[model samples]
Target: MSTSTISLDHVVAWLARFRELVTEQQSYLTELDSAIGDADHGANMVRGMNAVVEKVGAAPATAADELLKSVGMTLVTSVGGAAGPLYGTLFLRMGVSAGPVAELDGAAFGAALRAGLDGVVARGKAEAGDKTMFDAINPALDAWDAAVAGGADIAAAASAALAAAEKGRDSTEPLVARKGRASYLGERSTGHLDPGATSSTLLFQALADTVTS
Candidate 1:
């Protein structure tokens, strides 16, 4: 594997790693969600990612976009609650931004990630400090871009993104919710980690593990 580029195989491995992480952290995710939102975030992610793996495994995609589009669609149809649509739109926009490429260089990968974040914003109306997935994803993408701008390879960028994402996820603990079901809690939402942010951090951690392996 090229250190500076992401291939379709890399994407597949990324999803696989994400599946593993989410499965391992399922109860933890549900614990987080139970504090401020519905308790199904963990189960929903595991189910969605399982369906994603099965769908992508059965139908081989020649292009990154095709593979991810399939993943987005599967999540949309299979997973319930806000996670479905938000995560679905993220992958959907990533695929669209990635186009029909067989490989994405660092810059292209960052662009795809940015597009995905934008799609999530468009779909969920989330912003900085919303105590949503955007909190983790936005900082992660910014770190990714910065690493790439500093001439880091894909693996390095992914590591930076994961680190930033973890920080972002932790930062959400003290924030009052302003979006999603968590928002319904108002100030009561404070002191609990955002399940979306925790899962979103796993997403980046999976990427880091995949590219560095």
Candidate 2:
């Protein structure tokens, strides 16, 4: 399969782009969460990403695992509520799977992503149709795998992942929340899009931006 090789530089660039996107969209995310959640998804995410940016800038990590592990640990400590642990686990697993590598091809990156998704599932105890970030993340990973299998490069695969993530995020609107605080609202959660799912889409979109730009 054809692949786009992603270096440590690309990983750093991706994180920076993700931080900017999350910061810019913070209020929108908070609004979404206010409908059915603790209403701090935006604040928590922005705070965590800002910490990540600060850490990265202070002491740059040349190895892939070192950089991602730092991102994971920062989120785990700083971000509040469910988003923190879930995203922290995602990065932690990805870092472990990435080992000490300096770069990854599309296939290797896909494996790392699969590990991250698994970590989310394990940490969140959620699955597809749970009306959570898993809805977006699972579909994006699937699409990324399929795209790579179909010979798509990193940019194309990331684009496909973003598209699938959007569809997954949209799919959550009609779902009755089955996990997290949103589940407390039951049927009231129906018709409102999940903040977690929306944020998950933003994550994939940032990943795509790293390649496209």
Identify the leading candidate in terms of TM-score. Answer: 1
How well does candidate 2 score on lDDT at residue 110?
85
TM-score quality measure for candidate 1: 0.98
List, residue by residue over 29-131, the lDDT tens digit for candidate 2.
Answer: 9999999998999999999999988998899888889988999999999998788999999999999999899999888898998899899998889978989
lDDT on C-alpha atoms for all candidate structures: 0.95, 0.91
Best by lDDT: 1
* TM-scores vs. true structure, each candidate: 0.98, 0.97
Query: Model 1 over residues 1-213: C-alpha lDDT tens digits?
Result: 339899999999999999999999999999999999989999999999999999999988999999989999999998898999999999999999999999999999999989999999999998899899999999999999999999999989999999999999999999999999989899999999999999999999999999988
CA lDDT of 160 in candidate 2?
98
The list of candidate 2 runs beyond 4 A from truth reads 1-3
Q: How many steric clashes between backbone atoms does each model show?
A: 0, 0
